[model samples]
Target chain A: MSTSTTLEEPKTGTWDGGNEPLKASYGKLMMWFFLLSDAFTFAAFLIVYGLSRHSHLPYTGSPEEFQFSTEWWPIPEKVFNAFPGFHGVDLPLAFVALMTMILILSSVTMVLAVEAGHRMDKNDVQKWLLWTILFGGTFLGCQAWEWTHFIVGTEEGMLLADGTRIFGANMTMNQYGPPLFANLFFFITGFHGFHVTVGWILLVIAFISTVNGVYHKRGHYEMVEKIGLYWHFVDLVWVFVFTFFYLI
Target chain B: MAAHSDHSNEFQQTGEIPKAQTKVIWKTFFILVALTAVEFLFAFTMDAGTLRNAIFIILTVFKAFYIVAEFMHLKHETKALIWSIILPMALVMWLMVALISEGSYYFDSIRNYFN
Candidate 1:
């Protein structure tokens, strides 16, 4: 059967030309464009990161002279070592792995929600969408824990061979590889985390709408699909983060 | 909107529909896992050498392609839309090459001048 234009057309009269103009709903199309621009912005940040990394380090002293940690630039694995408490267990990347799984699972649930939307199953749509939101929340919680762990020195307190306390921020270029690296890490990932929080809020609103019969009355679940696109975009950003920040 | 039809039987037969239009999430997931395992293997086994770094970056690009194409559903989009997203991204490759080369040069200079 021919897809009915009447059913698919934007209700808000956003369509300007009759040539189908991408033919997608206004929200979905706009989200795509927004993500495209956001992708470029991130690319610019990463490229600049590469450039800054290329720039010369004014090594005023020998590596042996650098006292705090023998390793240069806080190895991501060492820096982000907050896992569920198990005495005597050294889970270096356990938290990050959990965070990755949470984000991936959320993306899966989001796809399921959208699929339910397409099939017009309101109850299943709501159920899966709520699961997606829960997963997002769990990821955010884990991130908060990570930030706290990073900001606060270990429970054993800051230990230096020379008997000097290494404050978190002062754990800089000399101690943590490069000051710019830490700065960018906080700025870029923090910004992305903020976006994830916003996306989670939006998903929650969409979920509430679903429960209140907003989409049911409106006769389409396209809003959920639109939000799902946003959610998936967030997941895509994290994949880049994992590669650059962790693996690379 | 047309009344929600009783396609329950048809939907039940088909099972819960996937959000992605393509039926390749499982395939993509497996590919991603394999690529990641390779990355970890290389990370652990390879010595600190330029070749190892180069291979790592190549493997990363491969995994990135699958994620963008299949996971993000860009492969299913119209050619115009895909190009609009990709052409600008191509510039990032040049950016990476230029920046990394410059960084290495500066790093060597700093090492020599300060020491």
Candidate 2:
């Protein structure tokens, strides 16, 4: 009798009243499938980047002309300078490092929130979710500052021997590394930055839900877990960006 | 499944967990930092060449593996799901190599013809 009951339960569950097999929660499963597709989009961008770097153009400008002290695509340190508060202090690539830390720390807090949700700890979930949102917001602020610094050029624009501007937004091939290089940089990183912005918005929604006692009433914090997946995915992408765009 | 629900409930009441067996996150971060330092050293010390480029690309892949496996939790997922993510990426990898080689060849041909 027990075996018959177990078999009957699955039969009722399986056929969704049609040919199609019923599956897990539609929303949660769809989010995973969507993220998988997004991953491919990012892969396409990075692969094209590989192709561009390999292709050579007529070498019009020397490293010396572009104020690059090194041979490779304008050493990231020279390209990204943190805002000046301490005069005469050389804080190159410092902003990028801070941004990395912020995103990573946010991911940590996000995981904690997800863990809290599993336990149905309402207050703990709220607190950690808020922290995650703040961390993401702060990272976006830092990125905005970095973009401003990039666009406006840096302190008097360090002069080349031939009187060309060292750092600024007007980064054409003659002025910077390769014109294509700068173009790709803005497009790829900017697109990723936009993702970070979207992630922040989603975090805010999760935060609001926690505050409103929605999860508490619903009797589960699965929403937090789902958002946490998205948050971690953003951080994961940044790791690749750091390695490929900044380091390599 | 019951154990999972209990674990979730325990998490709600307290804001902590017995750390998972994998210290994967910290390991991934340190590996990335170490790789970055190596890249910086290479950039300053080495001349531009095919060999240096090869090393840089290899190290980049190493860092990427750690990020995707540890940070993204792909390593913890089911084998079928893992293959779904990785197999498509293999195609992208092939495309990259093919496109870059052709691009380089085309550039060389253009230079030879013009010169």
Q: Alpha carbon lDDT of residue B23, candidate 2?
A: 54
Worst 10-residue lDDT window for candidate 2 chain A reads A63-72
Question: Per-candidate DockQ versus the true complex?
Answer: 0.29, 0.25
Residue B40 miss distance in model 2 (angstroms): 5.0
Supply candidate 1's per-residue lDDT for A122: 80
> Model 2: clashing residue pairs?
A118-B8, A119-B8, A119-B9, A119-B12, A121-B12
- Model 1, A17-40: lDDT tens digits are 555545566777788889888887
Over the true interface, candidate 2 deviates by an RMSD, in Å, of 4.5
Please give the distance, in angstroms, between residue A156's alpha carbon in candidate 1 and its true position after superposition: 6.7
lDDT scores in order: 0.70, 0.68
TM-score of chain A of each: 0.80, 0.79
Single out the weakest 10-residue window by summed lDDT for candidate 1 chain A: A63-72
Best by DockQ: 1
Clashes of 2: 5
As a whole number from 0 to 100, the lDDT of residue B74 in candidate 2 is 68
